[model samples]
Target: MARPDKVAAVDEIAEKFRGSSASVVTEYRGLTMSQLTTLRRSLGEGASYRIAKNTLVKRAAENAGLDGLEELLVGPTAITFITGEPVDAAKALRDFAKANQALVIKGGFMDGRTLTVAEVNQLADLESREVLLSKLAGAMKGTMAKAAGLFAAPASQVARLAQALADKRAEEGGAAPAGADADATDATEAPASADASEAPASAES
Candidate 1:
């Protein structure tokens, strides 16, 4: 490559390193052009797998202030730059490697930390961002529903108690006037009987 082209290539790789959320270095030794295309398609739009010269990639990594990738950049290096969810990208790479044994997962860097092959596999095993978010949303909705029920419970109980009191009052009101009239009639008869008894006493005197 020409000097300017080499410089541009290094700059592009460095930009990828800086812009990506995570990056996985791999050795695509025996993969054919068709297989590489299939691998790219499998990775989806969230990641870009590029075959670059190791020297340029190393220079780019160093330029981007990313360390610990120099040792991993040996022998037909292809780097997968993940701009979206790392887990999804890791999963794609892992599954593709499983199918094509020629694709070797060297190592990766994510969140300012270097990842071994085991770590990358573990990352692939994790749930995707969307799935995790959906689960969290479901949990939040359930919690909100419970809170709403709790808040409405006291009001529901109060309404029931009020209705019971109203029913009791209605039942007692129907009989209250009849009982009052009966007591009044008994009071009047007692006064009249006392007067009659006093009249007999006066006659005897």
Candidate 2:
């Protein structure tokens, strides 16, 4: 490649490295163009799979401030630059590799660390971002429902107690006050007893 073209290529790869959340380098030695096309389609628009020279990839990694990926860029190299959910792309690549024995998984980089082939496979096994988020939302909903019930129970008990107290007070208030009628009856009877005692004394005299 010419010097300017090489510079542009290095810059492009570096840009991809900087822009991506993760990247997986693979050896596509025996895979045909048709299979490559299908594999690219399966990865969707969230990733770009490109075949680049190892020297250029190394330079790009350095330019992008990434290190320790020198060994993964060996053989007929094609890198998958993933910007979206890493698990989904990893799954697609894993499945494709399983079907096509010609494609070899040559490790990867993600989340500020290098990944082994086994690690990449483990990544493929993880649940997608959507699934995990859905589970989180469901858990939150259940928690909120429990919290609402907890708050509502005390409020309902307080309301019932207030109503019962109000009813008792109303019943007490509607009748005469507790001791008024009893006191009046006692006073009237006392005067009769006094009159009876005076009559007996007058007759005796």
Candidate 3:
């Protein structure tokens, strides 16, 4: 590449680094085109692979405020994958490495933290972002449902109590209650009047 071209290439890589969540340095020394293609496909969506000159990548990393990444830009290096979620790219690369012997994962960074090979593997084992969101949504829905049930319990009890008192009054053959029974009957009857106001009105044609 020409001097100006090299500079532009370096600048372009730097721009990518600035925006990337995490970048994995891998040795694609012996990977065939088919193998690379398979690797790309296997990484799921939003993962990418590209060959980059180490020196340029190093400069980009430095410009992007990413230090300690130069160590990973070693010999026979060709691919730099980026993602919006730092762990996603790491996870994909780790899984790919597990299946392909030729593809070696040197190391990577996650949100400014340098990740070891093992760390990357652990990240891959984690549930995807979508799955985590769904779990949170389900939990929230369950909590809301429980709250609704709790809120309606007292109203339900009151309705049943009103029914029971009416049954008791009928069973007594319309005989008025005396003493404490009178007070209970009055209390029960008071709620029945209020119940008419509280009940939902049926639509009339």
Question: Which one wins on lDDT?
Answer: 1
List the global CA lDDT of all models. 0.96, 0.94, 0.78
Q: Put down candidate 1 lDDT per residue, 1-205, tens digits, no spaces.
A: 4599999999999999999999999999999999999999999999999999999998999999998999998999999999989999999999999999999999999999889999999999999999999999999999999999999999999999999999999999998999999999999999999999899899999
| Residue 19 of model 2, lDDT score | 97
TM-score for each candidate, following the candidate numbering = 0.85, 0.86, 0.73
- Model 2 segments more than 4 A misplaced: 177-180, 183-205
Q: What clash pairs does model 3 have? A: 51-78
Q: Quick one: ranking by lDDT, best first? A: 1, 2, 3
RMSD of candidate 1 to the truth, in angstroms, is 2.8
Of 2 and 3, the candidate ranking higher by lDDT? 2
All-Cα superposition RMSD per candidate: 2.8, 2.5, 17.2
lDDT of 2 by residue, 72-169 (tens): 98789999999999999999999999999999999999988889999999999999999999999999999999999999999999999999999999
Report the alpha-carbon TM-score of model 3 versus the true structure. Answer: 0.73
* TM-score leaderboard ranking: 2, 1, 3
